[model samples]
Target: MTGDFTARVTALLMPHLILAPIALPMLTAGLMLLLREERQRTKVAMNVVSTFLGLVVAVLLLVQAKQPGVQTSLGVYLPGNWPAPFGIVLALDRLSAMMLVLASTVALATVLFSAARWHKAGVHFHPLFQFQLMGLSGAFLTADLFNLFVFFEIMLAASYGLLLHGSGRPRVAAGLHYIAINLAASSLFLIGVSMLYGITGTLNMADLARGIAGIDPSDRGLLHAGAGILAVAFLIKAAVWPLNFWLVPAYSAATAPVGALFALMTKVGVYSILRLWTLMFSSGAGDSAQFGSQWIVGAGLVTMCFGALGMLGSQRLGHLAGYAAILSSGTLLAALGFGQNLLTAGLLYYLLGSTLAVSAMFLLTDLIERWRNDGASLAPHEQTDDAPFLAADLVHTQGLNLDEKEEVLIGQVIPAAVAFLGLAFLACTLVIAGLPPLPGFVGKFAMIHALLNPLGLGSSGGFVLGSGGWALLALMVGTGLLALIALTRAGIRHFWASHDRAAPKLLVLEGLPIALLLTGCALLAWQAGAVMRYTQATADALHAPGTYVQAVMSARPVPNSPGTAPGANGRPQ
Candidate 1:
């Protein structure tokens, strides 16, 4: 215990390690902005650096996973080393590490896919992407509410630019709504933080988690209200249900790769909900049943229903995919809302599967868009060309129109790539739909098992069931069926239909990203045990808030400070 304390305190006081993840990209972005030579090379360099950084971050996250509850901070300059109540702190733990890894992986894939377009457009793409990453990583790591706001702004501001990167009528219009809604959500987030700070007298998440209980009951209402408001802020970011009106248009209108990247934006909000609910509001302090758990479930189910219906209703392929992404998010949030330790474990794994699957699909859509028969340039704002080619054009579209020689040529060039992508997405869909032999299936099975378990269903306690559980079960089955129907329908149309016309072959640049994502899904299917264990541990930790409070409130001896002596349970003497 003493050693752990010393290490925690020591980690806090130490200089930042490498700072490679944030620094290298920011530096590259700077260089990209200034140096105009070899645009393609510059873009390639960006993708390479981002990929390298992701690998490095994954390693660091793995190292951190070895010590889940311990607090660590790398950047000292952000909050000037102030502890707890007075200044900013960026705290990393098991959940944040998981999110960081997922975000980095997705970001790296998106950047790689976008490489082909960046060179042609001559945009300062690299720096914006780097900054976007910086904001996302910082959001997960930061422990201070105000600083969370800061990073949120940084991320959204960067996203605003990305959404409008190569702007046009549709993108500009969609970006307006996206920006307006998020800006409003951001403002609400700040307001909620201020109210919580006023009541609890602290802005640090750990400190607030520790202090939240002692506040007056009325003041606790304010805290719950604050938490609820914050939940809305995140839900807006997550695009949960009615509040999610901005998502489809925003996603469909933005660059395909950019939309793929933003698919993660919703997860960030979900991550925050998981982090804060577990860390701060698990006890009777916040009417968690009403605010923390039930509401999320309700919103999630609504989101799922809405998204599935939207997908069924939409004719546009990109919009259909966007709705599907939203539905997957609802499943995640609803699982979290169930508030069962097992369900949370399920939520974690489901998150991984959905993120990888959605990301791969978005990139694939971008490639498909490029292959439109009109020979029309895909504008920055358009999902893709809407014109339909003759059924006979499929052969020509395969670049096989001229001769057997041309057919061989085209097949050798990019048809293999397209075939690989289609199969990958189909695999992902199976996972997403909770079919067997995939991690998504495992995750859903675990969640359903938890829901049906005797203890949770009140077998011993006389038919007692949590409000969120039934709704969640309904959502799980309901959404799964809807997704199955919708995706299968779309799949048959695109891959199996007998048509003479084929869209042009997509650029080969996206091959790596698609491969990376599909490989991740396969690995997750193979090695879900470790992830499920971590998720279980995380859920258990959240259920037992005492473990967290004890860890954060306890103090370590400062080398020369008189007040640093060990006290009860190593808390300040």
Candidate 2:
């Protein structure tokens, strides 16, 4: 009987696995709170198992999302069984599922990486980590504005603890700044959400889209005001320049695993803009159609340029990674503004590859810096380090060091750890720099192709590019070049400038996450064809807002259990 009960429970829960990505971590985190501090091993085990299970569920959802057809592929789960617009709804579609997979993948890898030593830095690390995942999952899956705010707060709240996980004066300072900025943003979030709800009777995103389309012309100004305020909150989170001063210091100060996972935080902002803008302002939205497209595109271009310049100005690996992330956000935001379906597809592809590369870069920075610290350090202008920096040092090439330096030009043995880090760094640089022969290059190429040849990819109609097209093309290439130069400069400084290099002690746990992230980048590049097809479909679905609305708005509440009348308990007749 017990076995039968267990089997039945499993069967029952299987259908609700759509909610598992969000709910699993919440339950796991709650259960973990009961454990004693001395049982850190158990906490770690629970954290890892829960994260791995979340990854499995994410992959399962991705498979379902990939199945062809709108109604079939778009999975909607009403938590309260009260239908959309009336109660909480969780959505699983191509876009949200992809984000779930990405979040879970990063979460599992970072948890494993932290297991090496980082998680021990602070109290409640395990629970905070799980809560962070829960927030990320919910933000992606939530089908309404209010729940998005709740999840955003959940994410930011947990990040507050994670940011200061390994506390130092610098970390505390940066974390405080991060918290203050986000808190302000959250206030704006609440105000905007409230305005939206007040203006329209519902906070459901799908219903909001439907309402916005038929909204009176006089209220358009108020509507735009609320959305603009909401966009500011997202832009702040996305680290759009001038508003991004806090990001580098905070992220750089985070522990390695935390820093890596924090890479997804900015993307959540980008994802929100993508979901709402596409749904609420599509071609079918009448007057609101493409309303803020120009402004977003302009913001994106400026952000891209600012990020590239910031990268060039950055002197450290952590700073470089932070700026690289900002650059990615700009690129994605800019692509979304272009209002082309094929461009959107390429942007999604780029988003995945760039996210992997940036996350790996964050992890790599800690390892490389640790290794550099273990090595003998010399001032760049100091007489001993001339060969690595001076063009004269390049011209004065000699088989023997002029001073018989410790670094031998003739077959110096590199530690396996050093070699591994170097290769990973190289991969990250290529992808983040958007260089050739990788998905980074392929994704951009696809975007440019779609831009120059809209008809090439089956777009519904063409829009005039004016001077925007030329400017975007120029910026795309220009930023890539700037990124390449900046990363290459940093690479030489870290890997080549020093004499008597040493490798830090590395654990499998520490190394595995970086390796897996880099490997994922490679896989994306290798499977670009299949990946693009999937992204193309996603882009197509995103451009078609009506389908999304129909799916969500048409959903009816689950029926009452047997013996209950249809109209019982105030149920709709």
Candidate 3:
């Protein structure tokens, strides 16, 4: 009887795995909200368990997406058995599955880290966190543009709450700016969606793609205008330059765990751009083929330069990590603008590595800052002014103690907490700087290789790298170098120069998550070949979106025959 019950439950769930990623988080968030605010332990347990289940579901979906001989690369789910272009649809493809797993993994880590302390810093943290996951998962899975907007709003709202979780003066100030900017972006998102719906008369992404082919020539200009508006909103959220001034300050001021989660937020914009551009604006898109390619490339290059400069100028670790996120976004955008499948594969890999690295850096920064005399603030103040004198005084006070220096000192022993932090910091530095033996290096190298060997560009079957390619190559290398210099300097100051300071108290929960994140990156590096192959497959699928469109449209339930319509009970004959 128990075996029968287990089999029945598995059968019931087999078809709905696509919805599990989004639904689980939403349900958990609702449950947490219903619980009393003081039920912190219960909330934490529920959040962790939900996130773990989400991660497992995401992994299963990813594996299913990569299965060979599949009719469609995407698995589509329709609620209430509604037909396409009418009812809501959830679709999971390699790209969406990959994103789901990444988001879930990061969410788990952030939640665990927060459980150590940040959750108690405010009420509703767990619910907001779950809601944020719901938003992210829903955004990735939705097959309709309107649903995308809904999920985007959900994500933005949850983010606003999380950003203000700890409630300091700086956090409040930054949170307000973050809220205002996103609200404006949301308004633009609505305008763009309305315009697209007005032109196409449909909000389903697959349907919109099909409709674009039949759009009147007279309406083409309006379609482009709407897409352009939508792209602007995405670019803002992606932190494309001039418009991204709020990112550094907001991310830096946010609490550690909140900042870690914010790392995934920018990627949402990048993901949206990649999805819509490939689906609705590919070479198959008549009259709109590769629209705004040059603009994206130009903007991406400028963003990269700006981000590199920001990293160089940043004094605090938090600010550096924020700028690094922007740099990663710029790199991915530029790669997409190049319209190369090989580059896209590399970009996806890099996206995963960089997001994890940046998130880990946020948590590590908080841990390291606890031991600093000035705490986490990077502002120039009196303590900074007296730094040189303090160094000199310390040297005179301790280094020249001849009376007590009769015995020679042996090797200096490091504390467990300090050693762990130092090692984790080193891993983060290598990953962020794209150094060798890490996934960061592997991804960047793949991108540079693709750029150098452009396919079918010359009579010899290989093309010389363009001026733009060379410029990008130089920018990537220079950016990595700058990151190394900056991080190395910071590491020495925090760990070596300040060795005399007491080690920061690290909790098991906090340290475990950080270690796991870095370890995951290392494992990715070790299995780079298999991971790249999967990413390359995802890139191929993205570039050719017919499978995605077909899967979604075909998943819609068939209508009844002309003579066999709905009966009095509304049941189909």
Candidate 4:
């Protein structure tokens, strides 16, 4: 009887699983808002449980998406049982599922890390965090453009709260600029969406793709203009080139865990570009096909160059992490612009690895800086200890006793805490620099190999790298070198030069997240073959958007001239 009951419950809940990732967090955030700020413990507990549930659901969704058959693997949930192109729908395919999982993983880590101290730094941190997760999950899963704007607003608003959580001068100042910039971007977003709706009757992504081919000739220019404006908004959010100036200060000033969470925000923009570009602007887009490809590629390359220069020039670790995010975004954008599905598969892998590395670095930066300032002495230290004695001092010391002269220090001993920090820092450096034996390296190698050999295995055709491809190759290697130099300099300054400082007390809560993140990168490296296959499959699905369109549109009943056919739950059939 118990077994039968369990089976029945599973059957009942199975149909609604697609909504869990978004709904769970929204409900948790609402519950958290109801609680008083004094209920800190309760809020933390709720936050953890909600994020964990989200992670579990995302994993389950990913598994479902990776099933043997295409239609069976994709999951589409229509609220109120309403048909598509009319009512809201949430679609989960391979790409969306993968994004859901990645976002959840980062959200879980940030939440865990924040519980150590950041939660207490503000009154509504937990609620804001959950709301941010809701926004991110919703953005990933929503099938309509208007809802994407809604989710983007949710995400930006939550981020604004979280950015000002600690309330320092730098944080507030940066927050103001961040808010202003994003508000402008939001305005442009609305304008573009309006224009898009004006050109195309529907906001549903699949439906928009279906209608683009039949759009009137006069409106084609407007559609392209709308798309250009939309791309500008996304590119700014993605931290591409001059539009990204606000990123460094805002991200650097944010609290550590919030900063880590911000690492995923840029990817949200990149994901939007990928999803929309591939779906609505592919070869089947008629006059709109491959629109702005050259502009995207050019902007991405320029963004990468700027990011690399920023990393090289940045002195603070926080600032460096911000630039690292810019660099990662640029790389992914460039890959997308290339329009090679295989290369995009590798970029997906790169995106996952880079995001994990950047988050780990953000957390690690806080811990290191905290240690650097803790119990620091006010007295001025002797800077000339290693310098040769002055002539007067040398003469006096020589006359007194040659043996009594102060001896110069040989080497500094590495402390246990510093050693641990050094090792973790080294791992971060390797991952960010795309060094050997790490997932970063694997991803970059795959991209380069794909560029050099576009035909894949068993193909006899020869290929030549385009100028853009060569530029990409050079920038990839150059950025890695630049990162290596910057990170190495930071490690030495923090760990080696300051070796005499008291060892930092490592908290399990603080260290555990960083360790887990790096371990995840390592696991990705270990399972590269399998993960690459999955990413390739995702790439294939993205390139062929028709399958996705069919899956989503087919689920809805054909509408009559007046309205959709009447169906169950008052929804049109």
Best by TM-score: 2
Best-to-worst TM-score order: 2, 4, 3, 1
The TM-scores of all predictions, comma-separated, are 0.83, 0.91, 0.90, 0.90
Query: Per-residue error at 69 for model 4, in Å?
Result: 3.1
lDDT of 2 at 13: 64
lDDT by residue for model 4 (1-573), tens: 999999999866765788888889899999989999999999988998999899999999888888865453337777656777888878888898999988888888888888888899977999899989989999999999999999999999999999999898999999999999999999999888899998898899999988888899989999999999999999988989889999999999999999999999999999999999988887788988888877887888898888888889989999999999999999999878877778888899999999999999999999999988875322245435543366337555655433344433443355676677778889989989999899889999988987888787632222346898898888889999999999999888887663444668887778888887888888899999999999988987787788888877776533334554454332211
lDDT for each residue of candidate 3 in 1-573, tens digit (9 for 90 to 100): 999999999766666788788789899999888999989899999999999999999999888778874435337776646757887878878899899989988988999999999899988999999999999999998989899999999999999999998888999999999999998888888898899999999999998887787889999999999998999999999999888999999999998999999999999999999999888987688888778877887788888888888888888999989998998888888777776678788899999999999999999988988867534323345347676566557656666432243322443467899899999999999988999899889999988988877673321221245766787788789888888888888888888763435556789999988987897899889999999999988888887788878777776454555776442111110
What is the alpha-carbon lDDT of model 3 when measured against the actual structure?
A: 0.84
For candidate 2, the lDDT comes to 0.86
lDDT of each prediction vs. the true structure? 0.71, 0.86, 0.84, 0.85
The number of clashing residue pairs in model 4 is 1
Task: Supply the TM-score for candidate 3.
Answer: 0.90
Better of 1 and 2 by lDDT: 2
Question: Is candidate 3 or 4 superior in TM-score?
Answer: 4
Q: How many pairs of residues collide in each model?
A: 10, 0, 0, 1
Error of 4 at 53 (Å): 1.2
C-alpha RMSD of candidate 2 = 5.1
lDDT of 1 at 337: 71
